[model samples]
Target chain A: MIEWSHWLPILAMLPLVGGALTPLLFRHRPAAACFWAVSVASVTSVVAIALLLRLVDSGGFSYAVGGWLPQYGIELRMDEVGAFAVPASLLVLLSLVFSRHYVARAVDASRVSFYYALVLINLGGLNGFLVTGDLFNLFVFMEIFSVSAYALVATAREPIASLAALKYLLLGAASSLLVLFSVGVVFAMTGTLNLEDAAAALALSSPMPAGLALAGLATGFAVKAALFPVHFWLPDAHAAAPAPVSAVLSALVVKAGIVGVLRTLELFGGAESLLQPLLHLVVWLGALGALGGALMALVQRDIKLMLAYSTVANIGYIFIGLGLATASAVSGAMVHAVNHAVIKSALFLAAGAMIHRTGLRNIDDLRGLGRRMPVTAFGMAFTLIALSGAPPMAGFTGKWQIALGALQAGHPSLVAVLVIAGIVVLAFGIRVINALYFRPPARVAVASATEAPASMWLPVLMLTIASLALGLAGTPMLEFVGPAAQSIYGTLP
Target chain B: MNRRRAGRILTAVLIAALAVPLMYGMVQLPAPGHADAPAHTNVSAGYIERGAELGGSENLVTGVLLNFRALDTFGEVLVIFTAWLAVAAVAGTASNAERDPVPPSPVVDYVIRLLGPFIAIFALFVIVNGHVLPGGGFQGGVLLGAMLILLSLVMDAETVARAVSARSWIWLRATGVLVFAMVAVMGLPLAGYLFGLPDEPGLRQVLTVALELGIGIGGGAVLAGLFFAIAGADRS
Candidate 1:
């Protein structure tokens, strides 16, 4: 009876069942754990694609659990934006595929199954969050993924990893509580947890309670997304986490917060008094984050940490687009979210491969690797160019769209912040390119390093190619997400 | 005033000043128990009026928790399970059979021995009656977990270890989410949609009870496992 249209929820749950089985199946055969995890995520990706196509064909759909009508029962809703789950799951799959050799080397052998299990669980939580329409359901899904992320970040077994994970755990848990508090407030105001119902109810009600609830939800998501002034914990946590885990964290987990913000905008779009002010705040904070994060990235010598800070900056770019609250701007933000997920994961995996080959984290230590690890070097270099908002890569399309959006919205000053931030990011990226391709080896390990195995580099290369393909053929993505932008802000550019 | 004192006072005043609007908003909220309150006039009224037929549980709370907002409950179950996995991943799985057993305390041991069976049965009763009564899976599971911890507290570690192997503990702790997910998906065919219960009142009742038991058992096992692991009771 489900046919193909109702497949969105299944795409989320399949990885969950696989997560439940992975540990038990690989109790003695730990190697199979990675394979099991990839197979599950791959299956979820395929189904996600099928679901995406079906939803596009049929337009959009919603499934109310237990056949109970909305405003009463939980709903699983999918529109163009929710289809972001497709890219999220595919990126996670690629990360897991890259994780096999990396985890075997980076993590303790005995704990490999547990690591893979957490990865699958994180994937499930993310996918579920993407499609859920209930506020409390979102909180619950957020917790599911955040808890696993806290754990997986520490799986690296380094002392710093543990400390950073603990910090992340405390902050993340506090933010989730804030999110829950906001959900409670919204429920109290509207008496319905379904987002569309609540939004309609909020539109009819006074602005005060909705405003407070908005404050709570904004702070919570801002913390989750690592927005400026609240991103204090990201660099350490992302840098200290295992490379594969870093890829997942930087690429998808951070985007979860921005996704939450967009959903909130869509839900509250009709409440102009509330949304207008919040969107203004989002714009300023995003501008600050873009500048601050890039400056911070500019000072970091560790390539992973630099990537981590750059993630904070890239997040700023997406937020600025989203906060612009215009059709083209939000579309750019959405497109950027997808592009960053691809390019950043490629960056992390490629950087992870270098570290795996040479055990060096500092950019200077990894100098001359372009000659040694040719494919990985190419991946790292190309991702850098793409990420710095240069031409010929997918990253430029989103930034351009956002800048163009600023022009459309009559806020040309924000374009200044975008350009300045881009230059900072570009400068940092160029330094790394210089080190990787131009500078002489700084250590013996760098001079003697060999190329990473195909299991490791293959996914990185695929992602790099994906980064190019998505950039060059970005019109389809923009068109696909156009309706989502229109849903929040009525007209399109 | 000194600069530091001035700064501190200024900061406090600013914070309080900022909070005035929020406090003013709260003061304007509808009085508790008002008939026209949003909480009563909106969706809660529908749940109370029709949750039984719509959600298939006598207890409206359970109806909401299990059927109306089943995905939320599903997510809740995943949260707990993920917590256990996170802790276990950071701290490896325990092997109590190899550990040095703590000596049993005589009087406390006798007390737990007498109370353990009754507590176990009571937990089961709570879970089964959850649809009609106040107690449910989470409460029953905590009680069950408390019983095991109490047993571990008063008696030898070996007894608990013999009763539940480390491997069994992992599966039992995981059973909650695994079962919940399986049932949610199974709803597609068994009923009509994901997490949809059969419209038949009888079948819905059966599945809810099954879900309750799964949650109870899984929660209890995880609580015990998490505690015992943290207490160093199961460390090899």
Candidate 2:
């Protein structure tokens, strides 16, 4: 049997090829674009899973493009962290699968094929971003996805959609520039762009430039990850987007920032003093983010806006795990990244299905949708619990580890913030749940609304079940990430 | 200010507070580009020592881009291509119905008509000579793209449309990525690396030129496609 992952380059390239061929394949057959895009994403996801499995079994491997030596070339290195491509690709796959019917109603008919094309390109960009080990290449892939995301956000037919995308473009572009500036700093300091070499080299150098580089990298990724205080653009951008677009943005795209932060942490493994203060900064920022995001989320009337703010809070959770900077904490961050990608996408897709059916955006208008749309309502409920960190779900697994790690790292205070954020999340979850199940229907349209098509509801159900499965079988997942986490934290250079 | 505005002001203040540590960190960095800097030591020394021999290009930048660090260039190529996709999606007005281009001022049209051929030749030269010279895929691609827009400016849309119809234009626009991907696949069978060019000098030359031509042609067409899309001249 062929070693499937040896074709990793092709696996990432496959989507770009599909994206390039989409307009050709579906020029007149616009309806087939969705199917084509879905097929491409599925293949990419399969390969990503295969690669992750390989990494889990044999540890990860590196591929040098053009066969150049590490000192002179770009390296695509996949470890436990890089296995993020699996969830990222799978989430993109689900979103596109959900978009088949959703896109017909949500977007202009003429641009349907183009929409799928953008999705494929975005998928390609994301996979490439996760796998590449070179810093500048990472920035390059960041732009690829960011540019596609900006357009996708504006793909919806509204003035505000374009306006929101423009604001996103401005802010996102600024983040990208900051990332590039840091890349330049590293390149100037180390004469190399490869992450491992740059890190090893910087370990021997003065701390001043290294600190500057770290600061730049952190600030840039903070914006991308939507950390507290810098999260102003997220609500408008996420809410205004077409739902599938928002799902992926909320789910996988922001994870890119966390991935970047982790990579930088790993790269500068020997710089303990630098990482110490950075982690301290991260812990406090994450605390504020969690508290602030939940507080803001509680007041939102629009369901999607509430979900977006909740994402900010969850990002805060992940950053807390990361900022604790213990092996367990980093592991928790990784697990949460995976869990949130699944839960949040499921929630967004469910929300999208409901919105598609009844066209209600506000939580109040969606009252009693549980009776009308049983499957989506239940899916949303499971996702809400997952989001709020309830026990016996993926959410609790990550939160438990992170809280334990916070104590391990001697930060008892973050655990308090964790509790507070979780409670607030519970309050909002109850609000949405009450609207879905407990309350009487205020709108006749919502009262009579039927379930979305199988194509739509099936993905929501599948993702929800996947999250539950991940939680129940959470031990094995943690075991798999165990080596990867230990490798990152244990052998810090 | 009202409550919302006050809250916004508070958040802005907090954001600034967070950025202060970062500014302090920047201030602490050594000034960039000193010969004694950490970056000038490790991998930089090695690349400078043998990049040409290893990468088989006379020009070090081209060698690094085409052979050593080709993946980054590939990602950059994809980034620009994605940007074109985004631009087309947002503002693309190109319909299938080809419309006549309004005539431009004689001076402008005549100048472009006269210089377009030379510019095209120069772009080809830049791409072809990239292995031995400064300009490679991106520079040549940009030059060629600029030339295409210039040609379109002087000649009517209908004239260009007839030469490369909307249907054929799709393939043309994808030529860069397709050719790049194809060559990448071919590398697997040829040199046992996905983006590897052959180690043989002649083969390296051939592969580098082929990549240059592919990127140049593809990038130029995509740029022109963006122009048409934004100008609303594209039709399915």
Candidate 3:
């Protein structure tokens, strides 16, 4: 019998190793590279799903790297939080499948293999980040994904891509430095890099440095999560990248920031004095982000830019749920993270397909695409409504739960905020739907455009179905992540 | 102009406000080198005590880096490799037509050539002696990279490129991640966990040295690749 715990490390390693070999083995053959990358991601997805199943059956487990106990060496664990690898790997796999035909035009020929390699490496980093129990390892995995994401943004052929990537790189580097510095501070205080051990130590430590570390980590992760006031870099970077890269960025990458924040909350669970103020502040910031991001998204002419802003809006909703610190609210936030990832990636890929076919990105220009490309347009339209938190769709479960939790927590104003944001989101969704199905073709590109290939539409279609299915599955998901929220927050109201 | 100046002033004010708490936090941390500081007593003490016997290196740093926290080192190595991969993907290899028109002076060229062999040997020494020495794969690899960069400065990049085929160069660049991964997996059967150094002393030593050499060569190649990508030596 296999010691299934061993699979945890391999979950991260397989992709990293496979990615490292992609360019070496398929440098000259991009089609082969796509096949190779998809194969590796598929295998990784299998491993991730298997591990998640084991976690469900057996509860959470840990694997100490090199046989050294957690205190002396790194530990990789699979809790409900780490079970995020399942969706993350699945999303990357779909994105890779979508990339087969997309990259042929979106990226330069010689760099195709490198594009696939970087995406795989980014998944590897994200998976590693989700599983690792060591603080420094968290920082390392963050860099691996971050560096790849920066480069992935630049892989687009647009002239603005380089500047956007540079902006992202600079801000990302600053955030990473903050995280590393905080890690240093924690290490100095606790002398142990293990998250559990350090958390125990921090519970009893002096407040000043502990508060600083908490502040640094919260701010750093907030920036990465694109919380309001620090989300300036996201719109440009996400909007400018190739569509599949954008999907990955807006979907899995930013959620890693949320995961980071969750880990921070777990680390400081015992330090309630420091957490309360931060939580209170983030709630208002989240409200601002929810409103501001929705309004910005509504006004965008470019379809991709609108989607990018919507990501910020959704991130805002998740943060609000997190900040409320109620059981339902936190679980709602966690479930919403997964739902938003599914819905947003579906939206991005469908948008990418339209853009790929017509080379048009403006909402007005993509008018009448409904007739020209039925499947892609419908997927986009369905997911768009789902994205608006409409009932019986993926977005509704989390928003409703969050609103319930807000009222439960005596923050009725936040429920109003959630409703207003939802309505604004629905307004944009209607506008886009009207353009696609009602408005006549206004541009030559729209009139001439055809549906994208099966590779592209298949993934979009799958995620579109998933967005609805996940909504129906919401109760179970909330139940699943219930323990995780409880464990991370340590007795939430 | 007044508004811009006011904005600058506001920025400075905010930064200063931020720095006050940061500095205060720094001051409250246990002072450096304090005998009882957690940095000295907790995990570090364990590493100091048993690192040589359990971690399989006389140099505690190497023991920790290679045996105790080997996964982080592997990640660091992958990070470097990914850095080169990213640069190559973004900027692309420079076309041969874009090569520098200026040629190097004979004196500088001769001096670089003279120093190259010794630098290479010293890098090998540092890497191989990492079990007992301060300098290991990363440091030695950096030296090797510097030598390559120096050579490229004086010699034709085409000549340097031709020394190894493009395919082989890529494999060499991937050596660190690949070899580290291989050793890590080997530990599953031999030492009962991923990234574990084998309990057999002789075999463990061999695997550690192999990891150092792989990382050394791989890091050196990736650094040189980054330089080439920036300098436009990549024809592909």
Candidate 4:
């Protein structure tokens, strides 16, 4: 009978600690390594669901280790925000687990353990980043996650992987530097590195420096979240990474940055009037990322690269909701984050499995996949429908909320951009779906062109189920996200 | 296998095995209290303080890093992490291991032979004394990493790898984060904050020292591992 609070930390650590120990224990046993890794991840998923239940019943709880107090020691402050990320992270982590067999077969045998370790660390980093209350701790966790990501992307040893890793490394380093400088500036001015304390300090201080600090933070987070002008590293990096990594990267890592920016805004926005201008800029940038990324995706021949660009486009929708900054809009963004994580992770893993089966990554080369690999083809189709914001899907509910928020905000221009972007998204989505499912088989089916093994398809199935479940049964979720959105925008007055 | 060589290697391994844990375990011991005695606020206020201060600087650590003791931390640790990355990237692209041309300089070699052990000891002292003194673990750990790097450059990559394996170094790096997270998470319950080390002077100092040891191990290992990664790239 483990206490509920203990479950929260354990859920984050099980993957991480398991990752660190995997190589030592199973360096010689790939099957055993996969079994253990999946077990850890599955347990984490169950724990996350359990933790969410505790949150619903108890509201927010803070757990301190070594009997230390919040002001003086480190803590895990689990609030509505922390609760919100649990299901999403669990869904993604489980997908990574489900994709293990596909990855083991597709990737080098010697690197299998290392790959699982990186996945576990990525999960731990994401969960820790979401849950931690301290600013510096968040940065530390961000580095762990980013470092693991850099290596995971380059692990394939493809030329493109190296180039993408280098590109991501440079941008990631720049983002870290910007964040460090901003943290330093904020600490110097406020004499506190805690988010809530810093928020109060900013409210009391003059606007000029505080505004500058906010700009530094926003720009840094924007680069991580890969919003329009700062999103150049995303396509190459995502396209080059191994499939499960791509799913986690696009679905989860980028959202962590969005969470960071949202947290910053929540703590500091109330007292500052300059935030409105910032919100305006985000709206425009979101519009551009959506339109530009979708247009770019339309021309790509590589399926992975095309999906990567679509990620940039999907990210734009999130920013648009965030920019709207209304209760419903913010809730929509939160919901979208969870929805995208599930759908995108499922799609990428399915794409990876397809590639694994066929030994091809290009759209043209993927002909007849639907006939040969029905499960993957069908899964990808379901994901595409969700990605396209089709009805009766997770993506639709999020977009619906964004559209409603835009209407409430009286921003017709933003609404027009959203509508146009939606069309572009639908266009590219159909282009890929057509190439995947409708295109005739150019080559006879090989024995390899079957549905992925149960391990790989299981998580994909889970994510697909989540996407549909969230879409169909969102009343509870909508209610759950409401208090969180209120915390961000303070219940609209 | 050569008997004498095996015996020497055995001896070296034994020494390392014993020494490494001793080094870490020592940092876990109780630490001294924060200095309570008043000192001159400005450098010009005292003779000893004057020489330690930068001409225009007010903050001591910033002054030490940017001015007087700058080469050790800023120049050595931070710059070296950058240099390792640079070498790794360039050498990785060249598809060859980059080699240094000159042999070890006798003068510098002799100096390190005499002073290396003492210098490492002094660096540890500074790290442990950070609360009362100006220097902290980051600077000290960099110095330690620099020492390993120097040995690697003067001796060989194999020697350095033998001294501390890359696998263990990576573990050390992770351990640093785990330790920090543990300490911070520990603070969540009673302290109402993360990493809020108790104000009881003795306990606080002890905690700080433990934290420093973790940092030192982590920073040192990262520096060593980065070098190994870059240097080992030649094999690929």
Candidate 4 residues lying further than 4 Å off, grouped into runs, are A1-14, A27-29, A105-110, A443-448, A491-493, B1-102, B106-110, B113-115, B123-137, B164-211, B233-236
Interface RMSD (one decimal) of model 1: 1.8
Question: Which whole-number lDDT from 0 to 100 does residue A186 have in model 4?
Answer: 63
TM-score of chain B of 1: 0.83
Candidate 3: misplaced stretches above 4 Å? Answer: B1-11, B93-97, B101-105
Clashing pairs counted in every model: 1, 10, 0, 26
Ranking by TM-score: 3, 1, 2, 4
- How far is B67's C-alpha from truth in model 2 (Å)? 1.1
lDDT of 3 at A124: 97
TM-score of each predicted structure versus truth: 0.95, 0.93, 0.98, 0.81
Higher TM-score: candidate 2 or 3? 3
TM-score of candidate 4's A chain against the true A chain: 0.95
lDDT of 3 by residue, B1-236 (tens): 99999999999999999999999999999887998999889999988888899999999999999999998999999999999999999884335457788988999989999999999999999999988989899888998899999899899776786789889999999999999999999999999999999989999999999999999999999999988887788657
Q: Give per-residue CA lDDT, model 4, range A143-253, as digits (tens).
A: 767777777777664678878988998998889877776675565555555567667666776555566667777888889999999999999999998888898899888
Question: How much is the lDDT of residue B224 in candidate 3?
Answer: 91
Docking class of 4: incorrect
Task: Please give, for residues A73-185, the per-residue lDDT of candidate 2 as tens digits.
Answer: 78887777778888888889999989988888888777777788888888888888888888888898888788888989988776788888998999899988888988987
Best-fitting candidate, scored by DockQ: 3
Name the best candidate (by lDDT).
3
Per residue, candidate 3 scores C-alpha lDDT tens digits across A1-493 of: 6589899999999999999999999998999999999999999999999999999999999999999999999999999999999999999999999999999999989889999999999999999999999999999999999999999999999989989999999999999999999999999999999999999999899999999999999989988899999999999999999999999999999999999999999999888888899998988898899999999999999999999999999999999999988888999999999999999999999999999999999999999999999999999999999999998999999999889889988999999999999999999999999999999999999999888999999999999999999999989999999888867776446
Cα lDDT for residue B55, candidate 1: 77
